[model samples]
Target: MHLWYAYMTPRTIVPVIFGLLLTVVAVEHIFTMTILHGKSMPFSTMLLSTSGNGSDLHCPSVRLSARVLPQIALASYPGSGNTWVRHLLQQMTGIATGSVYTDEDLRLHGFPGESLSNGSVVAVKTHQLYDETFYDRTILIIRNPYETFLSLFKYIKANHTGAPIIDKYITEWGSFTANEIGHYGQFYTSWMKHLDVLPIFYDALKQNLTQELHRIKVFLGQSGIKGNVRCALANADGNHLRKHSAMPLDFFYSKEKRLAINLLINQTRKMFKDRFRNVSESMGTWML
Candidate 1:
């Protein structure tokens, strides 16, 4: 009977083969999800980073102490020293830091949203803080209010044309909520006060970088990090800085235009301070 079945059952043999394929696939998935827990088996052969940057996989079974998808936002108004801080952190931490990743990346990859990846820590940088519900920890890097306004005015006037009238752009696009037209400062101020957060002064970041770095390390927990702070600081590579630099100051800054922008910025700051007088007290931290 067994010999006859083997010789006569083509349909049964097809189902058997398909069943085996499905079983193999299921086993692989189980290994990846259940047994591995998003990490590959340690001490087994592993794939190297494609860029020849060495494998993030060092010790088998262990991952970087940083959260799988941690975000490092260098929050600042234009010219408030966001880029400088980014450079310093990249150098000091031996990690790639920048503001380029889009909202899609944050939502899709193991970045601002997903569970942290094994051996990877995702740092995101941006001046525009749109969503308050995101980020495990948010760090706000602030500067003196008057200087912040001056730098912003210089940047916008330099980059955009039709100077004094530029408040239209800020009035229209800068608010956290669409209906809050002519209220760009509200968005900026709201961004200044949201999430599980820390506040870093830009002056401190520039003048006393060591102290700032120490604060950052403490925030991130320096127990598992390697290398000396000087080595990390010396590692600043300019590859990630904004290329095709535009000196906005050369392009626009009619005195009239500067005044208008300054007015709007001041008004925004006032509105922000007025509306959220006790944000820190209310939220237990400063979450907008």
Candidate 2:
């Protein structure tokens, strides 16, 4: 009786212990290699790239595995035309508004909706700064930093929800261009440091949406994304794009201020022409 009980206990206990140990080791390895390795790009890069002129930053040519075709993230800061790009891409790629997913952390009500995973290729819009610790493939969209700040300022001033932090920027309006102004400064710094990901100017989206859309389609194609993704991205009509909703110029400023800001934005954007062309061409031409 004792020998029978001993044999049965040993047989059952050994396999259970072995299975548990193996599971723990596998989990530890996955955490160490994937999450802790610092191999993926951080969301911070997306936010920072929108702050200033980072045209000269050297970036590695983005490479993706042929099997995955890579996920494309439309990264930028607030008021930097992310939604506009989304509107254009959704129409171009046939990604329904119902299909586009908002950032999980920023979702208004903690509602879990459809993840970008349902589609073969995921294109997300991000407002986080780039940090090389998260994100797979980043496509940065930039607006003039001054205008970015001005728009934010106007939005906040209009909303005025009694938050104390609002004063930090308002009080230092004159010092906005200084390095001390972190909100927009970090964006400028990041853009200057990373050049590998493609950068699209807000001005370009406004000036010649058709050409820029074509350039974007080419970039995605080079990354091995095809079929529905490619066709959806390349299908935007500039005329239709011009009609998309935006932060109305009248939201915070008089007509004169809006015109002046527009003029300034155009003037500064002209300085970035060469950089835009270089980045776009490097991504190659799409069949569209």
Candidate 3:
């Protein structure tokens, strides 16, 4: 009798333990799916109810514009604070900004309108130079070439995260600068020639965010801004903003490299000055 009872206990206990383990795994999976994908599930509902705090399940305030909008291009060279600008625009307008390419990170972060470029979103981001037929207007954000290069370098090294680049890549800056400088110049030059383009300098935007945002708002004709401009200003530096230690130009570039960058900068500045002389005069501001 004693031996029979012992065998039965071990067998029953094993099945019970296996069942409990399976239940735990199922609950864990449901919770994970609910949090990441925002799917509603029976277990997830119960879990949230018990926890009494469901802020983690909240989605960003940004939503698709109810009315179809014109396809505006948010054009910029890589690493020119384009993401930051998109954040500000979405936060201010409560409209999701689109991108030609669907960046999963940005999609998960706050850009629910990523990869949507069918005139539904507020604006579509693009690094590539597109023609007039593709977009109604272009918002070109240009940064200092030197700083832009460094930011791009760090951004690539950090794998698109906001983390700082390791010091080891400092040695590679010269070749990187040489390789990318021409492309940067060409990108700006091409966009500058676009018939309907609003060129906004990165420095100017940073210095006067409110003014810049207001200008952008007017350009986009976005009268239904759901978010307060003051609130957007207060939270200007969203999680997407990357903070890097300031390194001198000499630290990243040799004299020759610096000369090449300066020459391009000057040429670009001249082109801008020549192209926008009338507009600058009218606006009373040469934003280079």
Question: Model 1 residue 107 lDDT?
Answer: 31
Best by lDDT: 3
**Candidate lDDT values, in order:** 0.46, 0.47, 0.73
RMSD of 3: 9.9
- Expressed as tens digits, the lDDT of each residue in 1-288 for candidate 1 is 467456757878888889999999976775666333332333354322222343342322222334344554555555465645554554445444435444352233212222332234423466565465555555566654434544555445543112334564455323322222233455466675664455666656656666667776676553343423453343332322222224343233345544555565566546445655533221111111
Instruction: Give lDDT tens digits, candidate 2, residues 7-101.
Output: 66776988878999999997677546533432212223311112124333222111222244355667776656665565465444433211144
Q: In candidate 1, how many Å is residue 61 off?
A: 24
Q: State the local distance difference test value for candidate 3.
A: 0.73
Clash pairs (backbone) in predicted model 1: 68-116, 68-117, 69-116, 91-232, 158-248, 164-257, 194-287, 194-288, 195-287
Per-candidate TM-score against the hidden true structure? 0.43, 0.45, 0.72
Measured by TM-score, how close is model 1 to the native structure? 0.43
Q: If ranked by lDDT, best first, what sequence of candidates would result?
A: 3, 2, 1
Tell me which residue pairs clash in candidate 3. none
* lDDT tens digits, residue span 121-240, model 3: 888899996676788788888888877887888788785655444564666766788899889878877787678778887887878788888788777765343454653554467667
